[model samples]
Target: MRTAYSVETVRAAERELIARLPEGALMQRAAAGLAAVCAGLLRKVYGARVVLLVGPGDNGGDALYAGARLARRGAGVTAVAMDPERIHEGGLRALLAAGGRLADGVPARADLVLDGLVGIGGRGGLRPAAAALVERIPAGAVVVAVDLPSGVDADTGEVAGAAVRADVTVTFGAYKPGLLIDPGASRAGAVRLVDIGLSLPEPEVEALQDAEVGALLPVPTASSDKYRRGVVGVVAGSAQYPGAAVLAVSGALRGGAGAVRYVGPAVDAVLARYPETLIGRGRVQAWVIGPGLGTGRAAEVAEVLADPVPVLVDADGLRGLDPAVLRGRPAPTLLTPHAGEAAALLGVSREEVEAARLTSVRALAAKYGAVALLKGSTTLVSAAGGPVRVNPTGTPWLATAGSGDVLSGLTGSLLAAGLDAVDAASVGAYLHGLAARRAASGAPLLAQHIAESLPEAWRQHP
Candidate 1:
């Protein structure tokens, strides 16, 4: 599992490490790593043009020191400070000694540009001075951000205003939540971790790697039967959108569930698509409600909630949810909502939820006393407590009609197969995204394509 700590936690760790090390030693270690990455990106560091956007804090120092290293290797390096008086004296001296010069304005041509204007400590948006430097960056230059992209929140991944868009980000010590979640994640093109040797504590956010996800998957035993493997009950679709039921069942059948029992008015549509589906609910370990269910089905949603089994709610079922009723449930409940539905539940605007996805997901989880899965560019799974799991797999092509319905069924199947709320949601999202990437290699794909690719995604593991 990949873990990310808050800015506060990372600062504490950095301070402790700095106290024991010699003065300037910690900064030098960070600078060395930064320089190495830049060299690799340049391929031939000799005669390369490097521009460093220096700031008023340690981030600027890291860039200056790294620039000095490149200058020693015969690269023509230029440093542009946001404020000349506030620049780090030691770093500036080092760069000048190594043949690097201070530049009054951004050069028109450069092989690489280092965004050191702001680091993890900076908040809100960039000041006018820094934003101006960022705007002047030459096109086609490989922009590398030191630590994190400027104007992004290290803790929440929120971008209040103009932020740097980097081709690569070299983070030190630990990953920040902003690097893993959007819209900061989108700004951060690719991320590289540099170990500064700071011992850290539990992370506030985590992303499951492939191996971790494989371990969480349920494997049938030698003595297992259809019933033992688990059955998933799905209540979805209506006259208006019968395809939703077909798509949901398609995902459920491939989600490790031995059998799927479906209920609702779209019975004929589901049967015609999946003949193996058991019509009408019998005994099921979990239930998936909503998804093309249309409006005015609150009673059916309530009926499913009353059952003593895990339930995954999505789409139309997410409307007008009662927090107190969900909190009182005897079994686990997973709520999957896109930004719009999440906004409705939280009584906030969609723009607010999208801007602050981390906060919105956590708020939904705590308010309902259930696991909440916020689906978007970066899928997030969070419960009442514990670290929020960030899904690192997905393609922009996954954003399509009825795609969410497929996710709901897959997650419900995992819940039926005995995975806890968090694991079910996280693993489901991981596979769902991986499947989408496979299904839509670059072109547009239908919702059923994602469902069809689930088996191949599962085969990636043991």
Candidate 2:
């Protein structure tokens, strides 16, 4: 698992480590790692032009010291301080001694640019001076951000205003929530972790790696029959959008469920696509509701909610959800909603949900007393109280119309197969994303293509 700690936890760990080390030893260690990454990016350090956007804090110091290392390697390094008087004294001295000169403004051209204007402590967005420097970065330069991309909230991944769009981000010690979640994640091209030996605590956010996903996958053994493996009940689609039922069932069939029992108005459409589906609702380990289920189906949604089995709610089913009803449920409930649906449920604007994904997802989970999965460029799964799981695998091709319908079914199947709401949602997202990557292969893919590729995705992981 790739873990990310909050600013508070990281700072506490840094302070403790700094107390145990020499006055400037910790900063030097961070600078060394930062410089190594910079050097690697610029294969030949000699004669390369490096510009450092220096600020007043330790973040600027890390860049300054790293710039000194590059200067010593025969590279021309220039430091542009946001506040000349507030720059790190020791770092500035080191840079000057190593043949690096301080510049009043950004130069016309550069091979690389290091953003050291803000660190994990930063919130809201970049200051006017910092934003100005970021805007002046020379085109075509490989922008490498120190610690994290400036202007991104380290804890929430919220970008309030202008933020540095880096080609790569060299983070220290541990990852930050902002680096793994979007829109901060989109700004951060690729991330590289640099260990500074800060013994940290439990992370605030986590992304499951391939091995973790594989271990969580459920595989059938010899004594297992159709019922032993578990059955998934899908209630999706309507006369208006029968394709939704077909796509949902397609995903469920590939999701390790022994059998799928579907119930909805689009039964004929589902049978046409997947004749193996059980026609009516029966005993099921889990239920998947909504997804192309047009409006005015609240009673049907309530019926499923009353069942004593795990339920995954998406699309129209997410509409008008009663928090009290969900909270009183005996079995686990998973709510999957896109920004617009989430906004409607929370009574907030879609922009608000997108801008503050972490806060919105968490609020949804807490408010309903159920696990919540916020679908977007960066899919997030969060429960009432635990580290939020950030899905790492996905391509832009997944933004299709019925993509979410497929996801709802896949997750519901996992829930039926006995995975907890969180695990099912996470694993379902992982496979769904990988499947999309395989099916799309750089081209447009249909919702069914994603469903078709799930088996291949599952095989690769195993």
Candidate 3:
């Protein structure tokens, strides 16, 4: 798993490592890794013009040292000091010794700009001087940030104000939450971590790796029969939007469920698409409700919820959810909701739900005594106990409509296949993102295309 730490956690780890190392050794390691990457970025390192946006802290120090390395390699490097008083004295001296020059503004058409304006310690947006320098950089110039971009919140992934939008970001130690989540993630064009020998604790957040997913996936053995493999029952779709049934069933079929028993008014439509699906729902290992089911379709949902099977709820099923309904339930329940739907349940605005996604999802799960999957760019899966799972594999292309419906089906299928609520949601999200990436492959793709690519994604796993 690719784990991400909060700014505080990373800083603590950095402090521990730095304390053990020789004075400036850790920074040198960071600089060396950064300089190598900068050299590889340019078409030709020899005589390429490079601009460094230098601030006051160690972040600026890293860039200056990197610039000195580039200068020695025949690159014309210039440093635009945002904080003249606080500049790294040792780094500046080293750069000057290596023939790197100091410039007031943007060099005449530089090949690349290194953003050393701020690091994880920065609180708000960039200062006016730093922001001005960032704005002065010409379009298409490859901007590389040291540690993190200037204006992004390292802990919460919130952009305080005007932030440096980098083409690439070279972060030190382990991954920061800002680099993996949105707003901040949008600013960090592409992220590369430079390990500085920090042994992090169990990460505050984690992104599932392919190997993790492969291991988590339900692979039936020779002794496993259809009944033992697991069965998933779906209570979704209404006459109004029967296509939702088709899409959800598509996701369920792609999951490792041995059999799917669908129960809803859209049963005919689902049967039309997936004829192999069991027609009527009797006893199932797991139950998935909502998706296309209208808010008015409470009767059908109540019937399923009465059963002892683990339940995965989504979409309209989120509306009018009585906390009492889930109280003391023998089986597990997973509730998946996008921000808008989550907002409804929380009695708050969608903006509020999104702004504090981690807190909101955890709150909902605890309130209902069920696992909650708050789906978005960084899909959050929180259980009733603790230790939330944050999904990291996703593209903006996955934001296309109908994706959530598919995710609900996939999560339900995983739950049916005998994974717990947390595992089901996390595994489902990982597969959903991988499928979308495979489907898009450099072009726009529809939701149906993403669902169709699940088999290809599974094949890539083992």
Candidate 1: the clashing residue pairs are: none
41-67 in candidate 3: lDDT tens per residue? 995899898999999999999999999
For this target, which candidate reaches the highest lDDT against the unseen true structure? 1
Model 1 — TM-score against the truth? 0.99
The alpha-carbon root-mean-square deviation between model 2 and the true structure, to one decimal in Å, is 0.8
Clashes of each: 0, 0, 0
Model 3, TM vs. native: 0.94
Q: List the residue pairs that clash in candidate 3.
A: none
lDDT of 3 at 422: 90
Instruction: Estimate TM-scores for all models.
Output: 0.99, 0.99, 0.94
What's the best-to-worst order under TM-score? 1, 2, 3
Query: Candidate 1 residues 317-422, lDDT tens each?
Result: 9999999999999999999999999999999999999999999999999999999999999999999989999999999999899899999999999999999999
lDDT of prediction 2:
0.95
What is the alpha-carbon lDDT for the whole of candidate 1? Answer: 0.96
Residues 1-462, candidate 2: write the lDDT tens digits. Answer: 999999999999999999999999999999999999999999999999999999999999999999999999999999999999999999999999999999999998999999999988998899999999999999999999999999999998999999999999999999999999999999888999999998987788999999999998889999999899999999999989899999999999888889999998888888888899998979999999999999999999999999999999999998899999999999999999999999998999999999999999999999999999999999999999999999999899999989999999999999988899999999999999999999999999998899999999999878
Tell me the whole-model lDDT of each prediction, alpha carbons only. Answer: 0.96, 0.95, 0.86
Query: Model 1 Cα displacement at 103 (Å)?
Result: 1.2
